[model samples]
Target: MAVHGRTEAQPIDLTQVRAYGDTLNDGAIALSFSLPVPYGDEAKEAARQLVRQMGLHDPQVYHAHDLGEGYTWLLVYAKSPYSVDFTKISVPKVSNHKLSHAAIEDYWHEHGGGEKLRVIGACTGDDAHTVGIDAILNYKGWRGDKGLESYKCFAVKNLGAQVENDRLLAEAAAFGADVILVSQVVTQKDCHRTNLAALVDLAEAEGARGERIFLCGGPRLSHPIALELGFDAGFGPGTVPSDVASYLVQAVVQRRRENAQPI
Candidate 1:
């Protein structure tokens, strides 16, 4: 197609995208579910009816197995007749440019010329998981990225797991921490959310909210959810040490510039 004496660029049709199986836009999907019924022919028919009620077509009970205790596991193949406008979807994400371990060190050297960034990390509340905090704060980092402790620009203290939020804040005050890193792994009954929000609220009440950056990480945490919960940033699963390091450096540098201080 030509527009205004120029050929128009071809754009993908994203408004009606569907799951692909053997071909594009086939809408073919495989679903697995368990039912409290015996593994038999009746279970297969029941699975098909359930798929039909879900608005899918041509439900095929390809596999049905006995899970014992009157339970049946079923795999169904079906075609969905629905689609979503991919172009209109929007999601909040961390906007900082990812930096390598070496680059982060170099950037801190160039921009952060004063005292090292003080970081205090802990697995607050009843959550006793330390793997996430250890990955970002320990010398032996997760997956091969050197942790913040390895960086000359940061002084990190990993307080292990299940530390009370009040203790975390008090320790941060004593350490004069510039950033607070929180890790919560056990989120049963939304306890992680409650614990995280309580920390932020306490910080605000103690007048430490403005002087420090608050970060959180876990399997359930996301950048958007963290912002909503009053955190400076959030890191989810698969986050490496360098990811948090880069963001800290950039954020501190920007904050210094905004305060009319040397970076």
Candidate 2:
């Protein structure tokens, strides 16, 4: 949480707190969950008693529903009767360089950038899921007004689900792509590791290894892991188009400068 105002209240120490729920004035909490039981007044009372037994005070069952068959859902409000400090806590985060959309466009245009940036995206191997890849490449942006297609500087070719390694490389070479986005959803049996390594190996064999940026995305992919596997960067869940676009434009500009520099 970002601090915006000063208060006389002593800072709450969240690090030592073992509570998890909404902080109400009287330590009250409202929760919902399902149970495999028949719905009725008896069941509702049982749920209230269960909450009370779980250390809450004066548990009250506000609603209960029969979710067909024997499954029942219940909503309960109860007093947790506990409080804690709220300020002493911290979490690790990625520190990638943040660049605005205009900045990216400016950098690219300054460094031989009118040529449409070619990007190839695929869900490699037998991982037939396309949701992750589509989230980044699809013209219809996800979670608001943001996606790769929104950027006019990039020409993306998203090869949806179940793409083979050989096919991806062939297309990248054919398209003269400047970047390759690989999405690996199935990590079972370390298939993700093997597939990622194969792409890098193929790129090296084709002499396009370091000439283009290689990006990986998945539920489990991370920056450190992608770097270890020879990728330029990694994006996990919650990645937007702007994030990838920023990195690609900056990287392309830097590469152009390095190649043009006379030794």
Candidate 3:
């Protein structure tokens, strides 16, 4: 229980915690969604009543817009009367160790010596979104971080969007790439899954198993999902060039050591 804008000192319980909006434990919340109903007075009332039915109190319909053809988008603010066990929640994540752009280049040159690490990246399948891959591989980083292209140590080959998995594998073989990066942005009907899986399966069919590193990245990609899909790693939202560069360079160094090659 709370008043005004402060939390009332109560027993700390993570097992069941309510949302905090105007005050601590207030259970206040906000949500926006599109409903199948047309926008009108009835739609607003429907939204308010809907929130109330969900155990929320003081439901307020903030905004509602008709999205044409009997569809309405709405924003609602209300107080929820439920909570969950925060202590039992866990999410898998990628590498905790991130390398600087300079560090990545320095490590590659100092470790790899004469051979520059070759990396091939592409947006395989019918997904033609190049923005994601371009941001990581292009020199002018997407949101401020310089891409792998800016790094002097890596030989990056970005084949752009809508590349075929078989072509990617052929290029990987011809280029003798040390890392294979696949990006899929169009996830309509979970097509990213099928496209990414095809790349992995094709690489295996080509007998390139255990040779180069396989990495998948996109908005829908996750480390756990990538691992399960037979990839060495996966990169998702907010992933910068340095993060991918760090992992690939480190993995390459490890591989070099395992092969008794100087790195």
Candidate 4:
């Protein structure tokens, strides 16, 4: 395409774009799920019919397997003719997401200039998942960035998984933690929301909410929800340890500066 002697490819219509398989806008989609019915011809038909009922066209049961105990797993292929304005969609995210690790350390050294700040983290409640918390607090770190345990500016303690809220609060208080990090992965019946709220309540009861920065991170967490739960910040999936380290350091430095007396 050309406009005024300048060449440029035509832009895709944001409102009309569809999922592509063999070609653009083919609306090809593949879904995998398990059905409680036994694996058989009737089960496959049920899957196809269910897909059709959900507004997808030409549902094909490509594969089926017996998952034991009257359960059947299936891979379904279908075409969805739905489209949305991609440009009109928005997702909430951290606004100060670009700070580097070194920058954070420098700010702490210049502003607080105190000994290593204590940080305590764990998966609180009945949730036993530790992958999210470990990735951010373990020395091995997630991917390449060193976790908080490896940071020179932080004295980190990860209480492992399935920590009770009272225990977490007691330990954080004993350590005089500057940051209280929490991770919740098991969200059945919105339990994560409840567990996170309980932690906030505990902090408030102990009058620690003002002294410590409360951070909650997990696969289902977001900044808005975390704020709603009375947390200083919230992190979601795919967030690296350095990203967290930077944010907390920035927040602590800012807090300290605001508390400093005038010359």
**Whose lDDT is greatest here?**
1
lDDT of 4 by residue, 55-169 (tens): 9999999999999999999999999999988878887666565667777677667665677778999998999899899999998899888898887888999999899999999
**lDDT of each prediction vs. the true structure?**
0.89, 0.79, 0.86, 0.86
Per-residue lDDT of model 1, residues 202-263, tens digit only: 99999888778899999999999999999989999999998999899898788768777765
| TM-score for each predicted model, relative to the true structure | 0.81, 0.63, 0.79, 0.81
Q: What TM-score does prediction 3 earn?
A: 0.79
What is the Cα-based lDDT of residue 262 in candidate 1?
64
Better of 3 and 4 by TM-score: 4
Clashing pairs in 2: 12-85, 12-86, 12-87, 13-85, 13-86
Show pairs that collide, candidate 1. none
Distance (Å) between predicted and true CA of 127, model 3? 2.5
Steric clashes per prediction: 0, 5, 1, 0
**Where is model 2 more than 4 Å wrong at Cα?**
1-96, 261-263
Once all C-alphas are superposed, what RMSD does model 2 give against the true structure?
Answer: 7.1
What residue runs in model 1 are displaced by over 4 Å at the alpha carbon? 1-12, 36-50, 256-263
Give per-residue CA lDDT, model 2, range 54-94, as digits (tens): 89988888888999898789999888767655565433333
